[model samples]
Target: MNKTLVAGALALTLAGCASQQPAPPFTLTLAHINDTHSHFDPSDARLTLDHKAVFTRLGGHPRLLSHVNELRRQAEEAEQPLLFVHGGDAWQGTGYFTLNQGAMNADVLSRMQLDAMALGNHEFDIDNQRLAAFIQGVNFPVLAANLDASHDPDLKGLENLKPYVLYAFDGHEKERVDSVKDAGKRPVVAVMGLVLEDMPDMAAHTGNLRFEREVDSAQRTVRALREQGVKQIVAVTHLGLERDQRLAREVNGIDVIVGGHSHSLLGQFSNLGWADGAPYARQFTNPDGRGITCVVQAGQFAQAMGQVSVTFTPDGRVSRCEGGNTLLSDNVFYRDIRRGEQHRLNEQQTQRLKAEIASQPNIAMVAEDPALRAHIDKQYLPALNRAYGEVIGHLPQALKHVRLPVDGSGSQIAPLVAASQLYWANTPEVLAVTGRRADFALVAAGSVRNSLEPGALKEGHVGLELLPFANPISLVSLTGRQVAGLLLETINASLPADAHTGKFPYAAGLRYTFNETSKGRGYLDRIEFLSQGHWQRIEPDTRYQVVLNSYHASGNDGWSTFFDSQQAFTDRLDLAFTNGKLTAFPVARLSKVNGGGVQVHYINQPLNCQDQAVRCNTDARAFIDYVRERRPMLTALPESGVTLKRL
Candidate 1:
């Protein structure tokens, strides 16, 4: 062996070792938004800034895009690895969605250049075909690791709807590293997506697609990625904040979770008069107890954006995660100079508030993305404006819709919705279909999307924005025991501190006291039925005719009891009268079909209506009629429908 040969071989071996060495510590800046819900324009926001109540416009898509683009620019300047993603649910809220469907969503979101998005349950609000079309239109991947779409023809083999995507980021360039072979030993970050397994309970138009349990799918994906030598892992989930925390606790290798569905705004915003939430980029101990998993989410309706920066060790352990949520606003601000009127801030107050806003870490006054704003204005706004322009009626005072009972009262708007359903049931046309008038009406808090603002109300406000689902009115006969079971089951489902409060029940001719800390058989402290201008404890044996939306009748969102009891009446449902007699009548049953379609059937023969039989009563029509009957003004019911007491 010569000296020259030995030196050359040694140098070659050293070079090989250097090439195989572990990558350096990496920092990833994650920008995320969630539950935007088709709010293209700014919504009204009220904030208490510096002990002064003020009115201002808060986030819209145009402003959100501006902030995200700025962050992208900053990340590019720093040469840092960055990912921008949507948590889920960018559909079905305002008049834009009602008029344009998912076309507008696909167009707008594609332009934003998202890396990946979690599949939200509301995405299934339309049929499988439309959902497939929306997914096809988007430039980024629509992800759901738990979804099994093999059985559905529309979503069976989508190129972009994958379980996970891998990215390899070098100092100067970031490339989509889809395969382990493609990655070739470079440091890789895998972003996996997980959605709710209980899809049927939350969404009505899922088709043949089935969802796996979120934790199970996440664990499997993380393990697979680890086996493939992908160290850094991010899970984009639509499982809500608490579920994201649970996923962080249970999943071993995930470093961060960008979440939505519960629409949690993760940050301290109490100073801005917004509800305070868990701190942003909060870390949870992984299953191994040594690794850290950070969770973050933005507020609903494009109101806020969350930015998190995480530093990871070579072994994929998060050393630190820190970030905050910023509420995007415009410079135009207002103050309540008079009791009920909002006045534009003068130069002095405006300048002072501007200074204060600058000092706040989470409030960012940003401008709208000019191009996107122009696109919305030119392409979509005119149609929406004309469609929603007609005045329906007026609200003398604002009716608030709180999901959970607060300060001893439940939603002021949901009860109104329920009352409308009951009122429609008593109308001559509806009475011809069911032989009897409804004893009470039930509605879920989620059914009413927003509170009713005082002033001249428009068709767009009620029909499109407030009750956008447009669920058909349904009639069901329930015994007192069955009704009690329905209420108890739904109440218990919404009882968890982290549960989706949208399932909380509100009623028209019913009222109950709920003990939040109850350990008894059920949470109901007491239940009563309003009858003949009097209140009485409902009898267990008495059968009552109930009016509810078809969505609830099909047993969605913790209303399984309704389905189990009403399944027998798919044909002709028997109605019970106060005279202790049952009359068999042909009942109208509405069933959800493919592609956001509804299937209607009459048990025997169709009811005789003066006009269209099936079109005699609809959810929106009922509300419209009630509003017309009330005339010049609409107000909340005189009684508090729910009394919630906590220990």
Candidate 2:
């Protein structure tokens, strides 16, 4: 009797424990990519496998789509939640975007049936008229809460664009269809769109549209979404990672943030095999003391896709979250387990990882997507070939800077570009807008896409290398003091303090000496501007003209000084009003050239649709025109780093 009573007691205790089990939590798996930049191609990228360098095809749309689908299959099998998101800048970058004007990208991305996408600044590169047309191809909603486009009739035409949207997705063992939730209904997820308010500074600004404050728009959106019983709110944004973190902390009810614009790499060092970058997903708590918001970004060009698994409590609070980026390297990754846990993926695990990765469908290892390539070959390639394939000039020696040590310097291309841009800015066509001739040239080292190679260089090579984005050249007037200050900043950002700085200023008719002891604006020992055949000291407050690509003049890369002077710029280089006494060439009168050459590029002028008037306006065309004028053989620069020096 005693033994039976003991057994019964134990059974009753076990029964109580079984009855008190935890509730089933709502789970979601977010698969995302950002800043694709129309890289619908698989290019050769170098990586280390088993401690040795290996060349591999890193990314392409087909491979990216296959990876996404593979992950989707895995998620569905496990009954985990899944959502595919793009961070933005879907257009602008490669030859693909330049030739097709984002149509091909739109067509391809639309086929993915994306849940949502933020309107990146590059989306406005073609202006509002083209964006509206691009929207027509997208089946999914393209979001932006801050941009007030209702005033623009062209934007008003697109009925799909809105401040925020509601999406109902069920992750539990129940439904397949993800649709919009109705009033008073429960939603598995609700995503809102928020774009950076500084559109005027970043993209092509329009008169009819204005941007609202990001935080204010986000807070209002969260409050509205919450009132409708929306529990999980994800913010798809182009405000970049830093701002995303602040937005998550300052605003309540944001459960996740998918972002772009910085083209940053964020992931764990152990899992990612990269030491520098933000973790794949970082959790931030709101100041209001509510649920935490998880933020993530998949690096540029679909190189990797971030997969996040999140569990939320019944009351819409985050319970737990975990995930990281899956490197779409399309090659085997190996690590020695003998090293430690930090290494991750030993022999067996690496094999399993590679095998599983290989199981997914993929295309051949080529620089471009097969679909895009076929499309290009069929139509676009013919035009580009006919337009830019001619052997207009020859490079006797290869010009490169990839291995240079002058603070992220490239080969001879750096000085060559500085010479070429300065040459064009001095040209009759480019000089008219500013009403002043360029005294010197300034270019960012990062602007040299690839070094010019030896042998026969076609016009296409120019597009391939220097003008991947075809940025137009422009001129800016800076005081000698401002030029000195700019050089000081550039030197401070370089080694022995920071080894590699792509922002290192490359100048043709300019040079600066610096002392390592000082920093900030005083690092430069002296500044010089080459005028005629002599070098003269750059005096503070004395006006000097600097010519550069649109990238640098817009204060992108590192040259931050120019950001304050953005409005003073004219349409490229144009002869315009009143910059002193208009000494020489046709004041306020535009120059139309005679029939010496057929112009394929849009001439830089002070009009909104200046680029639209021509087929191309790339740095390539400018450099090509420069080379053709001095053709037969191009002269190479001095052997050593002769652009600058230490006093």
Q: Pick the candidate with the highest TM-score.
A: 1
Scored by Cα lDDT, where does model 2 land?
A: 0.65
Report the error of model 2 at residue 403, Å. Answer: 15
Clash totals, every prediction: 2, 9
Query: Candidate 2's residue-wise lDDT over 1-647, tens digit each?
Result: 69999999999999999889865777888888888877776544444444443344567676677777777789777866688888888886566676788787888788666878899877877767788888877877888877777677778747678766665555423232233344224345777788867665445334467778999999988888778667788888987777898898999888889888766667643322343567667899998887798988876776777788888898888878778766666543324312234544556756655554444322222233356447546755576566557787776655555422445233577677777777876777655544567888877776665555456777766775456655656665778877877776665655432222456777788876655553322366667788897988988888877777765665554566765444333233422122322212111212212211111122333323243434234356667877878654665666323334332
Colliding pairs, model 1: 127-595, 127-596
Q: Candidate 1 on 66-151: residue-level lDDT in tens?
A: 99999988888888888998999998989899888899999999988899999998899878899999999999988899888998
List runs of model 2 lying over 4 Å from the truth.
1-23, 172-186, 205-207, 268-275, 331-388, 391-416, 426-437, 444-457, 464-472, 484-506, 512-526, 531-536, 550-572, 575-618, 625-647
Q: Report lDDT (CA) for all predictions.
A: 0.81, 0.65
In model 2, which range of ten residues has the least summed lDDT? 591-600
Off by over 4 Å in 1: 1-23, 184-186, 336-342, 518-522, 570-617
Candidate 1, overall lDDT?
0.81
Question: Which RMSD does model 2 reach against the true structure?
Answer: 9.2
